[model samples]
Target chain A: MKKLKRSARLVEMTQYLLSRPHTLIPLTTFADRYGAAKSSISEDLVIIKEVFEDEGMGELQTHAGAAGGVKFIPKMPKDQALIFAEELCRQLQQKDRVLPGGYLYMSDLLGQPSLMNEAGKIFATAFADQEIDVVMTVETKGIPLAYATGAQLNLPVVLVRRDHQVTEGSAVSINYVSGSHKSIHTMSLSRRALKEKSKVLIVDDFMKAGGTIQGMVDLLAEFDAEVAGVGVLVESGEVESEERLLRDYVSLATLAGVDSKSKEINVKPGNYFSK
Target chain B: MKKLKRSARLVEMTQYLLSRPHTLIPLTTFADRYGAAKSSISEDLVIIKEVFEDEGMGELQTHAGAAGGVKFIPKMPKDQALIFAEELCRQLQQKDRVLPGGYLYMSDLLGQPSLMNEAGKIFATAFADQEIDVVMTVETKGIPLAYATGAQLNLPVVLVRRDHQVTEGSAVSINYVSGSHKSIHTMSLSRRALKEKSKVLIVDDFMKAGGTIQGMVDLLAEFDAEVAGVGVLVESGEVESEERLLRDYVSLATLAGVDSKSKEINVKPGNYFSK
Candidate 1:
């Protein structure tokens, strides 16, 4: 790369940092890339850092010392996140989304990359402080949300398959009762998918009676992995407190009620916004 | 938002453009956000555009006129994309990834956000010129890759479920023969999931006899949609040329052969690299 002017360097540096979130890059890397001095790189970073903070894009953490550099920690400010969550609640409340069995159709919302990306940013923000080694989610609908969070957190995503497949190699399978339907289902994970004793962050598109999430929690025990955190895009608020299989999770929206006959749906911002 | 310094504005402008790819943003939006003149915003975009192109980040397309703005079209240099494809081929060639029945375990590579993002860039670059409205793929394995491609192309992703779900409402299902297994399997998509006559870009993780890709193409026909393009991460080289179900698709890597007894997996860059 040839030497670039400060303006070009700033734009490139901002892009480099944005693309590689949660990874530390040495100042010298930028210095070398631009054919500039360390002091000049530092000055450029200071300007970038201020804009990031001021705009609430995220935090640029700089470490001092011979081996130190900077890391970009992506974050969504609480106020902005609240607004986005409220907007999601409104979207989820559409009457047509109600299904025959009181189920709400959310596949359309989950299919939107920009929407999922925003939700991922919120989940990433919610769990930024946790020591999460990987983002875990079930197969099917949850995959997109899981990947979204993983992208923002710069962590690899591990998917739990609903049925065992030969292509997965050796795997651990477990049976758990679905809380909503009271039906037994099997979920499995490849042995090589997750490391032993890894601090895992569980994510899902929706949680009903918390059975699937609890099933995942139980499955994690087989791998000697710890549940660092759990986050969901939506949670069913109709589940009785005692009937819910798990507690202590973050949700962006809560499905309060669904009247299939009347085609009425009620949704509100999830517990993410504490009143 | 208050007015920012020129350096700060440039940094903010770059971040904004990178985050919203392929979407046109009027210069007035930036001008208002930074409380700057349109002339100043134009100058800032010039710097960002030059850096984006020079660094192979992508291209910033500017449209002039009242409704005109700028759109970020992500691209990966052909040489760099080939290098990445070669690296992926090497990773897929590992003996441990060779499972029984000649199936290669690639969940690990697909789980990586960074790697998938890079692959997404390559696929996006491959289909950037196509008239694509949405990205389509099957359930489970292909969801991540589809979403990644969707993110890069600034498009929505529609998933085809293996089994129809009640929550999906009315759906159109079709049974397609599995290319490699020679077994019939059902794949369905919700009627409401996609608009009629959409231009669709099909993406998948693997293709053998192109049965699954063909299945998606068949399903698109039901919706009166057009197949704008097709991209796969890996394609099987063992499939007889005459027996292949589909033609004219892009692949990043090719699985030349898999020796189950000796556990030798031969892999190479796919047709993406003409040479």
Candidate 2:
């Protein structure tokens, strides 16, 4: 409420923009709040913009005219994303993470907030240009990543439950064959969770044969929602071409091969780098 | 990184501190990064600290002497928290949210990233003084809230699953009786998820008879962990005194009552305000 000097105002403005990403705030709003001239506010934004780019924090897009102002878009530089993916690959290559039946034990990595936040930033950057109304993920493991990306994109997250809970009210349920096992499984989404004809971005922690993703895509059709994009933390590189259920998606890492007997695991940076 | 001016350095410093909450960053690090004297970095922090408080963003705690620097503690002011709780109550009071057996449909609210971020800040402030090593919550609904709090606290989150999955490897499971149902239920946590004797903060989306919270508490004991604090977004006000399982906890809102016949619901701010 009180008029602050430029130094104090810059600190406050930076934090405000960081907190509320993807939302436009008019210059008048900041000008009135700080009791500063429009030109002064514009100058302050230019300084913030330069630092943001140099630090790899993100972008501050400015718009002109009465109805336009500025919007913060969270993004991770390609080199920084590669560094993160490489670190993740190293973590995944640990022999002990290989569970029975070739399942990689990554719950620990997923549980770490810093790691999840970095992963979220990458996903947010990958889908930064898409018109996504919501980020959707299946229940349990993927919830955190979905929430993290949603937070970055300033979008609501919609969760699909494996078993419909009574607490969610009326729900639409569908059965799809699992990619690996070829067994039928049901996934449900609350009717109220998503609006009709929304452009939805699908995200997941891991993908094998892309069956679960396909299931989600099929489920989205029930709501009359369009698939804007799909992103995954890891994908099974060993899946046969005929077995793969989905094709278009971005992955941070690929599980190339798992030698259970030899306790050898191979993890490579996903298609993200190649793209 | 190249040397930046005071204005540019201030912007970078604020964003750095905000991104890495609870972690200590020495002044020398900033001084070295910007090729500035420690005194300059200290002065910049002063401006950041003042603006952080004035804007009700959070606290920037500075420690003096060698091996000391500043730490950012994310917090939501009391008035802002109350406003958030009131808004949550209004949303929860919608008649259609009441399901059979008095269950409330809150998945939509929980799915929203902005709301969850606000709730996380409130919980982080409530237990800001506690020495918490990790944030814990049971499977499914509580995962998002737990992750959000963990992100704010800059701590790892451990999820206790209802059913142990093979992907989690070896797990430590315990059976606890439901406080209201008087029935036994199994809650499992991965043996690798938590360190022994860790100080943990428990969070959940909703609490009824406190059975689930109690279950988590009992489960924590299996890992030789200590319960630093417990936080819930909403607690059932209708639970009888004799049925209450836990009394020492914080709640953002209270579901006072629900009239299924008239489709009317009663809601109030939780005990967070009373304290």
Candidate 3:
């Protein structure tokens, strides 16, 4: 690589850090790549740190000594997260999104990368302090959200399948009754998908009676994995307290109520704000 | 944003452009954003553009005249893409990945966000010139890849489910024969997921006999959508030419052959390099 001027170097360095989040890069690596002095690299980092904070683009943590360097931690500011949640609620409140059984048509929102990225950042920020080994989610809808959050945290995403696929080799399948309909459903996970005793964060697109989440929690026990946290895009606010399958979970939006007869729906920011 | 200095402004602008790929932003927008003159914003973009090109982080396309700004087109250089494909092949060639019926265990690779991001960038670059409105993929495995590609292209992703769910409302389901086994399989897409005559880019995790890809193409016909392109992460080389259902597509890696008895597998870079 040719030696670049300070301006060019800054732009490259910023992109590099943004692309590889949660990974430490020593100062010597950058110094050698740019053929710049260690002191100059330090000064450049300081500028990046200030701008990163000013723009709310997470923190650029710096470590001193020979073995230490810098790491980028993606985070969403509380106020910004609230704004996003509010916006999501507004989108969710649309009457057309309400299905026959009170299900929201959120596939459009989940499909948008920009929106998913924001949600991912919020989840990453919420679990930033936790020791999470991997992000877990059920097959289908939650895959994108899980991947986005995993990208932000620089962690691998492990998917739990609805049905056992032959390609996955050996697997563990468990049946649990759905909290909403009291129907039995089976969820499976590849033996290779997760390691025993790993700390996992569960994410999902929607939570109706919290049955699906509970199933995941129970399934994790088979792998001897610990559930570090659970995050959902939307949760059913009408679920009775006693019927709720899970108690501790984070939600971005709440489906307060819906009037199928009048085609009216109500949504509010989830417990994320209160937390 | 507060009036940041030139250095800070550059950092902020870089991050902003990177996040919103393929979206046009006028110079005045940036000028107003930073409370700086258009001339200054133009200068900042020049630095960003230079670094973006030099670092192979895609192109910063600038449009002149009123109502014109810049668009970030995510791309992967040919050399870098080859290197990525080679790495993927090495990973796929592991004997342990070979399952009964010649399926490869690639969930671990697909679960890694960094790897998916790279594959996404490569697909984005390959189809950058195409006028694509949305990215389409099947449920479960292909969702992440589709989402990553959609993120790069700044487009929405539409997932075609194997089984219809009540939450999806009215859906269109079609049965297609598996090209390899001639077995019938069902795929469903929500009526609301796609628009009529929309240009779609189909992406998938793996392709064998191209049966699934063909199914998606046929399913798009129901929506009156056009298949602009098809991209797959891995394609089976063992599929005889006479059995191939589709030929026009791009693949990142090729599963050349697998010897289940000896626990030996062969993999190579896909058609992407040849093209």
Candidate 4:
């Protein structure tokens, strides 16, 4: 059989793996395709896997079962998830984060990849173990995180716009008093966004008053889909009422209170990975 | 004709604008359709505009031009983008962020809504002035930021999954060496993910060697798509590479270096939100 050296072989292996997210491909097939021995292919896989593993690149899951082979989990460990959350929280505490209304200045972080990546990990871990069919977030603020968690899990993310669209054609919208705003807000998901009985994980950037959160909760009820978990970038513990109904929440930062002046911000550890 | 109170009014307004991202809509339309007076519609639009604008909920663009009225830009200011990038950078600096072999721990922030929302804003700012037809990210890590940025611009995110599944009828693939490991990796995009001349922005969670980024870049060439910009969650600066040519980049943290033993890690900010 023709043989290729380390560099050439490694590229072929990764390219093959990259094309497939989580499905397992046996060693025998790879060996034949690469025109290398099974042992050689095995060795190459080890080298490639180790390099990627060290770099937090997508994973290579090897199964020993008769039908088992190598599969990529595309995952990051739990510890990795927490370190990221804590780091973002620290940055959020800086004096410059003080917005005009005492809100944490988060524009930079939101536009950044490091913080976004870490946040993705936290939510991914939150839903990592859950058998989720789709990742859902209300339109606007929640779309980015929802898409990230969905990517990590190899699931499709559906955006629930606050209003219906011509493309959606039909939708189910519910009016609920925002947990934070105390004023009513409408939350909606298109008829095509989801299917019945989907195990969903709901995520958003912030939960102030949670009118949107509860609105999503109510929207989920409309579809009869199970809420697998609820996660947010930041959670306001100050919001009154409706706290008991939440299950499986992960917040990177908890705003105890943004001082009246907005200059002094108090933050506590969030529910993310704290459990 | 008939009218709704503030809460109901805001929800309805938010829903309408979100459905038509990057498209212009006249205020008179909302006024006439809601059966409310133009003055009442103006008040509602003002409130809708303020909430999304103040909170970075979304961009509200009001064009007084003869051809325009009120259009949501789906964007926020640059200063806000910088704040988020800095916040994420500070967060990634924690000691606990250390992983095996001097690697930094990540993945949490990438998936978080808070961070992703910030990341999305940054990209929206970059492309806010550009006309992007679609947002593209290779499957897995880049998905969240890609989706978030896409939503902010009101564009549909297209994923370039590894394999050609039944759902993805056909695809184009490319091969490139991963910057991190010097291993060749194949990257792919579904044939239907985008169209020719589609303005694409490539986003990912991390950029160690940028091999994956390069692969995706090369992959886009296969589809005849133009890359408007390239964005990443985190980038490693200290590391040398033989990766593809890159035009633009946004990352939370850029690794400075590691101690001789790969301990005592150091990181500097990437070009994210550099005014």
TM-score of 2: 0.98
In model 2, residue pairs whose N, Cα or C atoms come closer than 3 Å (at least 3 residues apart or on different chains), thus clashing, are: none
- Ranking according to TM-score, highest score first: 3, 1, 2, 4
Question: For each of the candidates, what fraction of the native contacts does it recover?
Answer: 0.88, 0.91, 0.84, 0.03
lDDT of 2 by residue, A134-186 (tens): 99999889999999999999999999999989888889999989899999999
Which is the better candidate, 1 or 4, if ranked by TM-score?
1
* lDDT tens digits by residue: candidate 4, B86-189: 67777777665565456564544553544675677677777688767777777555666776787667666777655543323346877778765677666566
Clashes of each: 0, 0, 0, 52
Q: If you superpose only chain B onto the true chain B, what TM-score does each candidate give?
A: 0.98, 0.97, 0.98, 0.84
Q: Report the C-alpha displacement of residue B72, candidate 4, in angstroms.
A: 35
Candidate 4 structure quality by residue, lDDT tens digits, A119-224? 7666765666688887788755455567656655666676776665443436798887754335776767766567899898888887776567767777888888
Off by over 4 Å in 2: none
What is the C-alpha lDDT profile of model 1 across B139-219, one tens digit per residue? 878888899899999999999999999979999999999887789999999999999999999999999999988999999
Query: lDDT, candidate 2, residue B22?
Result: 88
Residue A144 alpha-carbon offset, candidate 2, angstroms: 0.5
Which residue ranges in model 1 land beyond 4 Å of their true spot? none
- Residue B251's lDDT within candidate 3 is 96
Task: Indicate whether candidate 3 or candidate 4 has the larger DockQ.
Answer: 3
Tens-digit per-residue lDDT, B1-275, candidate 3 = 45777877888888999999999999888888889988999999999999999888999998877878899998889999999999999998888998887678999999999899999999999999999999999987888899899999999999899999888888999999899889999999999999999999999999999998999999999999999999999999999899999999999999889998887999999999998
RMSD of each: 1.0, 1.1, 0.9, 26.6
| TM-score per candidate | 0.99, 0.98, 0.99, 0.50
